[model samples]
Target: MNEILTKERLIEARERISNQVKRTPILTSSSINKILNANIFFKCENFQKVGAFKFRGASNAVLSLNEKEMINGVATHSSGNHAAALALAAKMKNIPAYIVMPKTAPEIKKKAVAGYGAKIIFCEPTLKAREETLNNVIQETNAIFIHPYDNYDVIAGQSTAAQEIFAELNDLDFIIAPVGGGGLLSGTALSTKYFSPKTKIIGAEPKEADDAFKSFNDKKIYPSINPKTICDGLLTQLSEKTFKIITNTVDEILTAKEETIIEAMKLIWERMKIIIEPSSAVTLAIMIENQEKFLNKKIAIILSGGNVDLKNLPFK
Candidate 1:
């Protein structure tokens, strides 16, 4: 079925974006495996185009458009990776991309999105500012809005990462991924359950930005305004569609300290030589902090993204 939000749509997105996106490698790390007392498989989405898996969802959404939609162009708001991905995807498809970004978004991300030929609209760091900016642009150009994570097509495209990971490592007892706006987590939960119903799904959220965690417990997902966290990406509230999936499919919501995130990032970089952003490293932080709980189990973790600034390396 071509219906929106259907499992078939996710499967279709997996098939449609395969050519543009990498089936990012699933790696087994001896160091991590030894420490966790479990078999660990790393789904390295950092190796994806644009230094993150955001490219997959954004590209799929942009490229699946009809000629009419393409002509109207695509508009979106992102702190960084999604903007760059959307910009690059639209450029590749010969469509104009309009990106609204928080003024405080990293300079590197801004430059990368601009470099991809997307027109940029700078806004305050509030969701209100972003939505307003996006609306103005859409009204002016009649562009189709490609939300960063809320859209079904985007979630479906993001789910493909798990499809690839589970395909390679079918015996995983659990799959752990970092949650930010719940795109990856929602996609992961749906896809993982669809393929291996027995595999437990868990999401790692920053303690500082624990909306999803609180939402899970309270049974009502609440949207917060600019929650403080070093995991910059994990600041938004869970979407309605996303919260429903997590409520039903996710076995648990895990949290990790900001300091633990830094430590985890360092360990992966120094020990395994794999670079992961603090946001991405939160999953490892969860595993490290909750070590005894995961003993002897096989786990799959998504190394979500690697867009950390080099000058901002952890203090040794």
Candidate 2:
């Protein structure tokens, strides 16, 4: 009964973060539907606070903390939207936030995190360095560590995105999301399982960072090392909790080449008139790669984020 990954827990998370978070809109593209010969629904989380869905989980984690937990604030290591999200969420709670960022991270992301009043600590780009830096920050400040995608509260919070999708439209034949650390995909799979049992949960992964695809098929976790994909948000490997949920509930993991990802991202901007990060384009790329499977089906695509460094775009 105390399980945090259950439907009840997700529902509770929805209630908790409802007042603080925006209920992002769902958009449809007639042109894209014609191209794919399928009715595709896009849950646009790009419009979410901090320009990403990471805010939902971060806010949930921050808001869920007890009074004792709040006194020491929170700490996290992320070079993308998660850092900004956690920092902003902690600011909302009127508490201190310690953020560990790689020195090589984009200046935009660094600015976003600092703008939220978090104390930023620079570290080497490697995961080992980030973890070591974050550990030291936590040790020094006694801040609760809020992992980007590994915590149960974070997963439960992420599930609310799919809940909103089902609430608006429930006849989806397939629900697809990009798999980074498996938080969004696993959360989506659980939501689809409860709300639309017939819907297949599919994960879109970059071939350059295809650890999730490999792990899903191999039934084991694999390290993501020096990934050469433009999907910066998805460079991290899956956590044990995420891997377990994904293997159990997800129907499949499809991978897309770098070219396909860039092409899909450009197409969305041109057709849908929406800005999406490369990580978000992975889902559309998967649909394009496997057109036969998705043709004539009603599919839902979760656009993970819109946080892109405009100065460094993959497409012209």
Q: Best candidate, TM-score-wise?
A: 2
What stretches of model 1 exceed 4 Å from their correct place?
Answer: 1-4
Which residue pairs clash within candidate 2? none
Instruction: Supply every candidate's count of residue pairs whose N, Cα or C atoms clash at under 3 angstroms.
Output: 0, 0
- The Cα local distance difference test for each model comes to 0.86, 0.91
Residues 1-316, model 2: lDDT tens digits: 1255777888899999999899999999999999989999999999999998899999899988999999999999988888999999999999999999999987888899999999999999888899999999999999999999889888888889999999999679999999999888878888888778899999999999999999999999999978999998899899998999999999999999999999999999999999999999999999889999998999999999998877777776
Which portions of model 2 show Cα errors greater than 4 Å?
Answer: 1-3
Clashing pairs in 1: none
TM-score of 1: 0.96
Cα-based TM-score, every candidate: 0.96, 0.98
Candidate 1 local lDDT, 120-174, one digit each (tens): 9999987789999999999999999998788877888888999888677777799
